[model samples]
Target: MNFLVFVKQVPDTETKIQIAGDGKSIVEDGVNFIVSPYDEIAIEEALLQKEALGGEITVATMGPNRGEAALRTALAMGCDKAVHLEDDAFEGADSYATAKALAAVVKKLNPDLIFLGKQGVGTDNTQVGQMVAEMAGLGHIGMCVKLEIDGDKIRGEREIEGGRETIEVSLPAVVVAQKGLNEPRYPALRGIMQAKRKPIEKLTVADLGLSADEVGAAGSKTEFARLEMPPAREAGKKLEVEPEVAAKEIVAFLKNEAKAL
Candidate 1:
């Protein structure tokens, strides 16, 4: 079995973010970047699947030159190989164009199974895996907390509104991993040292047979007009009153002030 996992590098959630001077993107300087937390779960799930089923796992990602660091982290985590999709043309790519580029690679690799985070921490678009699946003409299951493989069938238990639903699909399917899928493992010293020697295959838009117009900003369906910090949150209100009165006040606050009713 050949398994492919898509991972992304994102600014650590704990890091403070500043809007770039261009006012359309975040400042990258001083921001610590790491493999997205959810994608780490996906990588760990793929590692587990490989351990049980006996296969090679390959991790792939798209970004600038720094993206290779993300792939190296995945490689250190036990993936057999890595592919770095890098090119200036790939910058500013929206989810659709990003999926298109990744789908092209997916077609080339034709792995038996594909795993990805349900969403990237930076964008939280939650669209790339599904789009890649659709573009590659493969079945997709999102928000999967459980996965089981029996011969040719792959069964996935995914989160629904309030419960979970199980769906079975054939091989060559995409699985968007959610939280609780599995705890990600840290890279051991040996793995980290070995990862330093692993060769990552670098690809570009031209390498994927995609024209510049089909990717990056030119291909994006949406564009950011501006980026700004959100307004500061107001301090919470405390009411010292009877329980009944407090409940009524909370209701009124929700309806009139919070407008969440």
Candidate 2:
């Protein structure tokens, strides 16, 4: 069995963010970057499946040069190789365009299973996995918390509003993994050294036989209209009044103004 894991790079979750001066983009200057945590789970799941079943796991992503870091992180986690889809054409791509680009490569690879994080931090749109599945016409499962490979078939678990449910899916499926699926592993020193020798194939837009009209900002359906900073929240006040007196006053305020009991 062969597994293809899609990884992505985004601003580190800890970084304080600011909207760009244009109000249509993030101010990425001096911002730290990291692998999307959700994708980390996907990578871990792929690694575990490979370890248990014995197969090659390939990691893929499309991004700027800095994205190599994310791929290296995956390398440390245990993917056998990496494919980077890089081109000036891919910049500012929306989820739809991004998925289209990813689908093209995934089709070219034609792996037995495709795994992706349920969402990416930068967009948090939770749409790319579905979009990729749609574009590829693969059996799609999103928000999955568990996965099992039985010969060529796949059995899995997904979360519902109330609880979890088991499901049976076929191979050549697209699975968007959720956080609870697995704990991502840290790179061992030996793995880091080994990762340097792992092959990372780079593809340009032309390599996929995709037209300029088929990808990037121009190909995207949605436009990022604008962004704004939220107003700061004010601090609450406290009184030194007696508890009984305060309780009575709080009750009166709740009933008359705050509208709570």
Candidate 3:
């Protein structure tokens, strides 16, 4: 079995984000980057699969030069190799273009199984995995919480609105991993040292036979018309009256101010 895990670098969840002067992107300064939390789960699941099936795992990602850090993190997590898709032309790529580029790379690698996070934490767009599967002409299972491989087929349990659904797909499929699939392991000191020496192949749009007009902002099907921060939360009100009075006040507040009665 050959496993390919798609990882992404994103701003740390705790980081405060600020809109850039361009009004379309976030300011990169003072931002702490890490592998997307969900992607870590994907990588962990891929590692589990590799351990059971006795095959190699490759981690792939697309970003600027700084994105290499995410790949190295995956390597330290035990992926056998890494691929970095970096190019100025890839800047400001939307989900469709990202999926297209990833599909192209998947074609080149032709792994038996492809794994990715259900969504990128930075964009929160839950579209790439399904789009990549469509572009690659492969079956897709999203929000997968548990996965099992038997013979040439994959059995997975995916989360749904109220419960979970079981799915079976043939080999050469794409799976979008959700949280609770497995706990990601911290990279060992020895593994980190080994990762420093692992080979990382870098590629550009031209190398993938894709044109600038077919990716990046040019190929984006949607555009951000405006960017704004969420409204500030209002301070909470406190009741100082007796318990019975406070209960009445709460009801009145809910009915009038909150309108949630």
Cα-based TM-score, every candidate: 0.93, 0.93, 0.95
For candidate 3, write residues 1-261 as lDDT tens digits. 899999989999998989999887899999989999999999999999999889999899999999999999999999999999999998888999899899999999999999999998978999999999999999988999999999999999999999999999998999999998899999999999999999999999998889998888898898887788989998888768899999999899999999999
RMSD of 1: 2.2
Q: What is the Å distance of residue 223 in model 2 from its true position? A: 1.3
lDDT of every model, 2 decimals:
0.93, 0.90, 0.93
Residue 89, candidate 2: Cα error in Å is 0.5
Angstrom error of the Cα, residue 209, model 3: value is: 1.9
Lowest summed lDDT across 10 adjacent residues in model 1 is found at 230-239
Tens-place lDDT digits, model 1, residues 131-223: 999999999889999999999889999999999999899988999999988999999999999999988999989999999999988889999
What is the per-residue lDDT of model 2 for residues 46-119, given as tens digits with 9 covering 90 to 100? Answer: 88988888889999999999889889989987899999999989988999999999999888999988999999
Task: Name the candidate that leads on TM-score.
Answer: 3
lDDT of 3 at 107: 93
